[model samples]
Target: MASFKEEVYEHISAVYQTAADEIKNGLSLIKEVWPLIFLLFLALAVLIWFAKPAPPDKVLMATGTGGSYKVLGEKYKAYFEKRGIDLKLVETHGSKENLQHLIDRKDPIQAAFVQGGMIAVDNLSGVQSLGSVDYEPVWIFYRKNTFNEGIHVSDRDIAKLRINIGPIGSGTHAQAVSILKQNHLTPTAPNLLSMNNADAVNAIEQGEIDAVFLVDGYESPNVQRLIKNPNIRLVTFSRADAYTRLLPYFEELGVPMGGFDLGKNIPDHPIQLISTTTNLLIDDRLHPAIQVLFLEAAKEINGAKSYFSKAGEFPVYMNTEAPLSNEAKFFYEKGTPTLMKYLPFWLAEFLERMFFLLLPFAAFAYPIIKSIPSYRTNLAKKQINSIYKDLDKFEQNTIQTFDPNRRGEYIEVLNDMERRVLASKAAKLATADCYSLRNNIEFIRNALEKQVIYKGR
Candidate 1:
């Protein structure tokens, strides 16, 4: 016998070898099933790609003139870069054109800055709003004294003269027409001229037009420039509260006297303007990821106080004609998706997509895994039972036949069964199954030996 230490080492080595063999066999089984695994994941990938698909690498945004939306577009471009996506800003005339771009099938526009009250939810069924971002205050700049040069006049007197109500396909134009119509001054009444912003500015400066209408923020470069000019007077409504009631979407805002330039005392008195919000709207066709991305970007850029809004007062779900986007609604309800809060954007998106896929995948795969052992064991049982059936037939034949030659044949069949049983045990039948085969073989041998079949029947 080997020494105790040597014997202990041998036992440990044997155990290790057995473990290694088992591990090798497991790997071999996995290798054999690789195609199945590949097909499963491939199917899952297809489902996820189709169902909760990842957003494209690029998106399109529609922004309007006067450097207001241009600044917002640039901010979104930088914001999307951190998430490894590109934001392409397409310039348009104004809100009406922006909405036109968003709703058009040929246009790849995903998001836009649209004015409130322009679209009714019933009319523009394909578009959705994220939230109202900021005030696009309807600014009416005109030659202050042109109505009665060297004399005094009133609002109606100024209204009778020609005015630039903005180009036809513009947000300013839409609101201007509506407001003018409210005052019963139709844009088509020949007193209103449809001119672009630059043209409108020129028209007013040169006395070609009495007034120019613009829908923009108080801080808009054009608004600021016009505020500083002596000839161009900002339109102030003393009856702002009454106008707000007349147009529900309009907010009554007071522009303090000389707010633009305290030193110059530009206004000389407070100006009240009726303003409507500019909403970030998305077409129903845009991906949800881009929708959420735009919402987040809008919050950071537009949520701060301008001359009108308080801090965190913007990007609000203002009562509107268009319905809100799903992602925007969720963002308002739940803040942010939980996974996205901790992980990088792309990774979080990937994992979120996979979670949706894997839930269904797991449901599909569970039954197949659960049935595997039963299927294999039944196959092995059939092999053993086949030999058992042969044994039963041999014994019956012996009883019916009296020939000695046939009896020798019966013994030979038993020998063949014994060999088959030993081979099955060696091949990897379960311990209990192998023992059952051996016991059955022994029982048959006893039958043969005990003259269950004899030369003299």
Candidate 2:
């Protein structure tokens, strides 16, 4: 019986041998498939390089100094914060300044709430729209006692009075200038004062300015305060249809009687207002994922039913001041991406990028992976063939020189070659070739023995 220690050593030796064999096979396989491995890595590197970068953790958006735009910006900021993103809001005069910020590449503002009709669409190039978010009506409020009672007010009449057409570089100012020009009135007239929404509201409330032209939503504090004040009256643009025709970007909005306050019958009459949409514009170079996030935020914040908008009616492709972004177009066509519905924002984005990267990589790597076994097999055959060539050379030398004096040395060389063949890793893969080599060695050894015996005789 084998001793216990000897048996234990034998077991350890067998385990070690198995592990070494596995390592050798792994290395051999890697060597044979090295080119395929290199190609796969190269393909992966190219895909990663071309892939869209991850959505930025911090972004800057331009809102208005005050009014609904600033309010909307706060809502969007809260939405972004929930997704682990920082949305910094920069307050400007209004849409005109916001559009300028978006167009200037050096400006840190990546997105803004731009009012339609503020500028010509042809002049905007570096900005794209995530679509219009809400209605910003051209609210014309005047002191009830300023104009003659029960008389219709004309654009020319308003231009001659002390009127606040909003600050320079504001959407209200742009619209006011356009309206005044259409009426053949001078917008540069001294009576067309430039004041911001709050100051203009205050000036009109104090009966200092005869009237104020504001472009804002009904929810704006300035518009609301003026609406509640019995002293100020909201203008009903009787020529609203003509204005829409003259200003192609303008839309006509109707407010029924008591639209402002049904309890108090605030307006006391149905009103026709000329309005424009608030477009969510972004830098054309903004990341696609971030654009998608903005669109989603628009849906959540602006899609709700409001005084002027029906539920899910906004965030639509209406009154687009600039071309719709690719992401926004996709969103309108298909809603939010499926991944974003269930997963966290960052994780969903990561998986989406990886999916796109791996899709092409898998197509490239499949054939190479499938051929690895064949490549490794071919390598094994080549190694066995090399040993066969050495055997053939030895046989030729033996037959030509007839080295009877060094017969022992020739036999020793044959034994060494056989030993090497049996020990070779390649021999395991080409078992048939290894067996054939052993048979050839035996036949050569027998011939050497016979020749030596015959020479001695």
Candidate 3:
């Protein structure tokens, strides 16, 4: 049987062998999974490389009830189709129904022009604003005789008159009711005429109704022509300030005389109007591509100079149930693609997709790639430290006793440490350290072989 010291040495050697084998086995397993791991890495690369889907060949949109939404929807549909996107127009029952349809996940409605206040917080759930297209001022076209009462009409007179409220679920209906309710008029049981703005106007012209209410931007040519009628007059809310105070989202706007046409002098006097915003409501989970498409379209549609809104005011993001997605928020804050600004529409959209794909990788590649070298260096450093402790123990034993039998055993340990340290090849330590230790091992070997007792050997 081997001596005690030899037994210890053999045990240490066995431990070293087992550890080395385990390391090799671990490395082998790592190599096996490396392909799948690389695939995972490459998947992220692919996402960053081609993340954006191609813009749809056809775009879908919604218009308010009556002619405005239909006319505008048709016009935009043609515009987008000219740019290679076929714009599909879906008629909705005006702003409230349009917003409800947008919130319904089952509905394929990607975008809709909704009267802003038509959507309450509960109704706005799961919907985001792409921006508003135009302001729809609450226009009260009452007969000149009914226009008496100086902007503050009494509830009794309003109740007695035949009021043409808009269609059920239309924003116009909601606005008319809200305005009427504020003045203590009860239309719930009153004889109500359910019709769109155009029909209401015709009804009034035909003597079927006494008054009609419409809420739309002043830029509407139809509205321009209606106001020009000598028989019908635009009702100015003398107390517009009070209505604005009652409705936080309402803005008191003025339709200046000759504002529509300076040469024509359309309005003889400035018409005071109170209006609510309109929104391009979309689903919360709407695809980023679709969201971008709507926003970009909105930028073109709503940014025009209108009587009620200036450029960049319609797509307001606040107070929506479906908050704007991060990508949409980013684009809104930073503005749309430069190509969308300068290039033709089709080319700009394609480049925008490519840019979305490449940007993340362009942002994150360097740091992750550089970590491999750093990890290997740390592993080597730990291995070097482990070997150094065993070397120090052997060195202390050598100083305590110089017995011949123990000297050879200690030399073997020194040799073992030296070989293991070289195997580790820890990059943190200088190469000079390994060579110097080798020289010490050589001196120990020489002294053990010759049985020479040099001082401090």
Candidate 4:
């Protein structure tokens, strides 16, 4: 007769074999759900790719001119350099040249400081304006006699005088040419000279030039000097209403005399001036992150309290050459960008990009995550049900196999199987199952002992 230990070892081996078979069967069933598994992996990959690191290297900025933009650009370049961004400063004639550079494929300029009234999108293509930075008032500084005297000249009289409108490629030149023509002055008859704003101002001071037109910011040093000058006078646009009505590109502004200095009492009365705003232009294809960064920079740079402007008066988006970019539009309507203002620039850019990429997966992923626990529970129940099948088979066979010699071996094997299954401790099985299994094992053990003693008798 076999020992109890030897018998129990065989039964325990069989139970483990059965458990392996059930595990294989479960895997086969799950194989049918390959499509869902594949989708889960795909979603994971997309999340990783979208949220993956953004460019950590360098950012590019475009700067133009010898004026305020150049000054502001220099400051930003220095600031960003310390933060590790590589700044690219480009020199152009003025705002008009800057806009053309952005639109031109040959030029790689990403952004520009574009003066107002210089762009006609009807002619140019593939460029957009972020928003206006500040105003460039059209300064019509003239010789002493031109405005002080009646200077009544018909279209015929305008043809007789000498005028230095602006440099050929400048934004001032574009608007000056239009206004002069509207007033019935021909370009050739006035002996129009193409001179820069500084040179024109100098000539007006010396009486070398009859009239000079400047379309530049009020904070410009040349403008300040002209404002304080008693000999030279700014040409007052008495027909401010007519100018605004006819020139849709222009807005009427008042240069309060002595506005520069209330103590000095410069101009006793206000001087009517024609003004237009300078816009921050970008290529239509420029990255959205760049657009957001620039708007953030402009908010701080343009709106500061200065000699010419009231606080919060600049960086306006209402009138622009091109429509505001989506990022810029969001900023204007909403109070402030939580992510951009609070987070690092590259980090904010990453979050913005990730939002767009993850939108499709959210609906599917949320439900899967919620149902995970129930799926795991079903798996546990299935494993316990497999153990129950083996238990039922052993119960049916125990009664039929009733030989005296083999009885001890059979009882020992059944006892071992019961011990293993009970040790598995499946939560799905009731507490009563432990009592029933223990009783059945004891009954088999007692019966086998009784048969052995009967055979000996």
TM-score of each: 0.82, 0.88, 0.63, 0.66
> How do the residues 101-122 of candidate 2 rate in per-residue lDDT, one tens digit apiece?
9888898899998889864645
For model 4 the TM-score comes to 0.66
The per-prediction CA RMSD against the true structure, in angstroms, equals 5.0, 4.5, 13.4, 11.3
Q: How many steric overlaps does candidate 4 have?
A: 3
Q: Which stretches of candidate 1 lie over 4 Å from their true place?
A: 1-24, 27-50, 105-107, 147-157, 359-379, 386-429, 445-451, 454-457
Candidate 1 Cα RMSD after full superposition onto the native fold (Å): 5.0
lDDT of 1 by residue, 16-96 (tens): 999999999888555545555666778777776678678899988888765577777788899999889998888888777
Segments in model 3 whose C-alpha atoms lie over 4 Å from true places = 1-52, 121-123, 145-159, 189-191, 257-266, 310-322, 342-457
**Candidate 1 global CA lDDT score:** 0.77
Which regions in candidate 2 have their CA more than 4 angstroms from the true location? 1-32, 119-123, 152-156, 397-402, 449-457
Q: How close is candidate 2 to the true structure, as a TM-score?
A: 0.88
* Model 4: worst 10 consecutive residues (lDDT sum): 152-161
With a 3 Å backbone cut-off (N, CA, C), the pairs that clash in candidate 1 are none
Give one digit per residue, the lDDT tens place, for model 4 in 1-457: 9999999999999999999999986685356344556777798787777653554355444555655567777765675564455667776778777876877866767778777777775656778777887777877765556653544222223334466778888887887787777787666554788888778778878888776677777767777777777776666676766777787767887767676568877555677777777788877777666666677777777878765567877677845557777767887788457887788876777786777666657776777766545555555455456655766676567555556667657777777766665765343344455565556667657756776433442
Best by TM-score: 2
